[model samples]
Target: MTVRPPQNLSSLSPNAAVDVLAAEIRMEKAISLERTGEAAAKAVAILNALPLDDPERPRLLAETAEAVWGYFIQRELMGQSSHGAVIRDLAIPREVLVRLGVRRMP
Candidate 1:
């Protein structure tokens, strides 16, 4: 299953939209690697490269975080311990969650 960014992301500046799209692509690749218990360093790098002040940073961070969580859940379900650990280690920081408007989660 190929993961894609929201179409409405086009409403952002061209450069911002492109950055988000690139991050989404990396996220998809990370998901594919996770299926085989591989690391997702490239995805993390892509997401980390997004500028903090970019208008689309929050959206892109949220989307990438969701994709990472999805991969983590899938690995957990499949009993892939090491891979799940890797995903967990790459989790989005709490500051990013706050930026995404997630005040808190249970």
Candidate 2:
């Protein structure tokens, strides 16, 4: 197989290349945050709807915790470290909050 030369960015000035790359990065970040938020929401909804006595309730709680944790980490990566507003806005259950980072006891 013939090695192909790198795609040309010489047509773009340094600033222009930087700006284009930045825009792409921003779009990627927005998409990531949106997807994470959606997953967290879905997990929370399933957990909330599960009956407390249901055997699946614990599993749902764990799933919700993982989703919420992922969302939080994504926000933190975006430099939004304050979670009080997010926690309040999402109405995350205290049970799930407590389970964040906790492993199930075998």
**Overall local distance difference test of candidate 2:** 0.84
Error of 2 at 20 (Å): 0.7
Give me the displacement of residue 36 in model 1, in angstroms: 8.9
TM-score of 1: 0.43
Q: What is the lDDT of residue 42 in candidate 1?
A: 45
lDDT of 2 by residue, 7-34 (tens): 5755777777778778989999989999
Tens digits of per-residue lDDT for model 1 on 1-106?
9654467984787778889878887787666756533333444556788787989776667655555555555665655646435635666455543443333243
Can you list the residue pairs that collide in candidate 2? none
Q: Which segments of candidate 2 are over 4 A away from where they belong? A: 1-8, 103-106
The TM-scores, one per candidate, come to 0.43, 0.84
Candidate 2: residue 30 lDDT (0-100): 86
